[model samples]
Target: MRTTLSRRSLIAAGASLLAAPALAQSGYPNRQIRIIVAFAPGGATDILGRIVADHLSKAWNTQVIVDNKTGAGGNLGSDLVAKAPPDGYTLLLGTVGSAVTNQFLYKNMPFDSATAFTNVALVGEVANVLAVHPSVPAKTVQEYVALAKSKPGQINYGSPAIGGTGHLAMEYLQSLTGMKVEHIVYRGSSLVLQDLLAGNIPSTMDNLPAYIPHINTGKLRALGVSSAKRWFAMPDVPTIAEQGVPGYDAAPWWYVSGPAGLPPDITKKLSDEIVKGVSSPEVDKRIKDAGCAP
Candidate 1:
């Protein structure tokens, strides 16, 4: 049997073919999406990831989960997202180290930070506070630098981990000021704060979220904030740049990313959702409450 197709039917077929990609991306959240955190739970990275995931779940009416894949100084989780399918389901909540600096420090990387992931959206910006325990007797960054020089390796300063922004920030300060101090590495901010509160570590350049309360309480003397400008949460506090290290800026940050090669439509959709999640008035207040700049 021979059947003639209507001209309208042929036009409809062509339209369907043209709409395939756009349709696929527009209906995106038909399934769950997962954001992989490169560090363990309770750190600034984890906190910001969870905040973004929560807002995304609401925005998309689909579940969004945070999976912690800690190890290799945040490389393991980052590599997983880098190699995942570009369907936009799997994303990495990576930090400055994972997305930018780790390649220079590590010899064998599973994926190139610059090429393996598409920069989705920035999640949060945290000023690392250069703080010393109340007993340290340091009132300013210059004094702290002088103290470190006098004590050298005997003065212990802690960071979340090796190669983390906190560690690198302190190292950069050392390089600029010619100050030498022992570096203490912890698994995450919580553990580092534990030791810091106990007076086991004398000083740290840790994220502001974990140390802000102590700084306000006078338990730790905040010598300077690592941001180029003073952080909003503590407007009275000075930045390291203003304090003495001119032009110094090593603030910790987190960003959303997905495997490279994602379809442009889906990438844009995801980026819009992420930007909304972190920048909305409600979320912005929450991020600042957590002692970060969204």
Candidate 2:
């Protein structure tokens, strides 16, 4: 014979389950929250961080500040947040370079990607554009590939850094096209863009926001975008896959995370707020205008 639980017992069990999340949520983020951007100001990461901080500040009625700590291909800033107190006050605006692919590229990383932090929320992804200086004779993707094939090692391309997403994406393109081209690594995007505009480097893959304005003014010509589909902002631009190379999708993503072992309540609260911020129409429009499909 089976018997149902008494009302008192059932009520107690339900209350216990509810209490756990409530306890986890309490006493979290009692002070200002600091978001660490692993790159310098004027970059995509810094811009996204500021937007998130502003939205969160208004929503939570608490101070949220973005701190730019740039170095070591984003390892310096990421490591700082990884080692910070597990309290909810400290957070990281982690990117694909710092969070997902850094381990594969760097040999002596300070923090272990597996245990350093918990993934809170994915902020968004940014598409990259393959752009060339006006001096290049290529007018379209087909023309560029043909020119590279004919020139072989004579054609050069610049990237923000060696083994960065831009570099790897171009390498993937090379593997597909079976074309040989020289690679030029710059310390940062600013240097890469400056050289590209000055006609020092003929071609480079960079974030769309950084190249879109120049592409519009005819300073640089966009060959294609590095995404699965055409961007909403640049509807006319074809994706690399559509142009020639098949299955060539590469983009950098931004995510929010805190140190490992954060209380479950605090985690939920933070994630909830981030989802809210990213879902806002204003934020969505800003992201779209940046030539990235959020």
Candidate 3:
């Protein structure tokens, strides 16, 4: 038989558990918070992650650090967060690549979005632009399809990686048009952009923000955007679906999430703070300037 604890010991233990909720509800984040970015530094995701971190640090009066864990197309970093403690101290600035598309691409993932974490809030949406080098000889989506059909497998497109949304979006486009195009994977979007500008790769589907300035300067040609509705920043361009590929829409989105089993009070506190931070006018303008819809 187990010995019974003294009344004072039992009372202290019970009080601690009872105080947990109260302490958590007092606007959590009383300590340092780590926001993991599942990508390398200097990319759009990293840049935006830093922006959010700065805002959160200022608003919460606590240290908000960004830790980049880039590998396996953002899987390594994501899995890290998925297994972290369910406390509010650790958070993930997850991307569409890590959250939604990876589920369809990977055979065995370490975590499931629905069960591994709680969605804090949506940060922003990055539209994919269908762009090609000037030598592709296709000015419109229909013309591009005709050209690809006529010379099946002759046209090649590049993406950040095989399982990235850029790759899947192009694959979806190919399925819709019944056209064949070789897929080329690059280290990152910057490398892809470098090759596209140099006429090494004929075409690619990438975040519009990366290529928007080039498109504006006539360095690259934008055939269409991936959003169903026209982008507010680039209203003149039509969406890929509206142009011809029906039901075609894809964009990389960013959101905050914490590991499963997080206390409701902590989860709610984080969600409210993140949503408020992303909704601020300054952050909204920065996101819009990046050619993403926040």
What are the lDDT figures for the candidates, one per model?
A: 0.81, 0.77, 0.78
- Report the poorest 10 consecutive residues by lDDT, candidate 2: 1-10
Which candidate leads the pack in TM-score? Answer: 1
Q: In candidate 3, what are the lDDT values of residues 231-276, reduced to their tens digit? A: 8888898899887788887866777777978776676666556667
Worst 10 residues of 1 by lDDT: 1-10
Q: How would you encode candidate 1's per-residue C-alpha lDDT over 101-170 as one tens digit per residue?
A: 7888899999987689866666667888888888898899999989888987888898877788888888
Number of the top lDDT candidate: 1
Off by over 4 Å in 1: 1-21
Question: Where is model 2 more than 4 Å wrong at Cα?
Answer: 1-20, 23-27
Q: What is the lDDT of residue 82 in candidate 1?
A: 92
Q: What number of backbone clashes does candidate 2 have, counting pairs of residues 3 or more apart or in separate chains?
A: 2
- Which 10 successive residues of model 3 have the least lDDT summed? 1-10
Q: What are the C-alpha RMSDs, in order, of all predicted structures?
A: 10.7, 8.6, 9.9
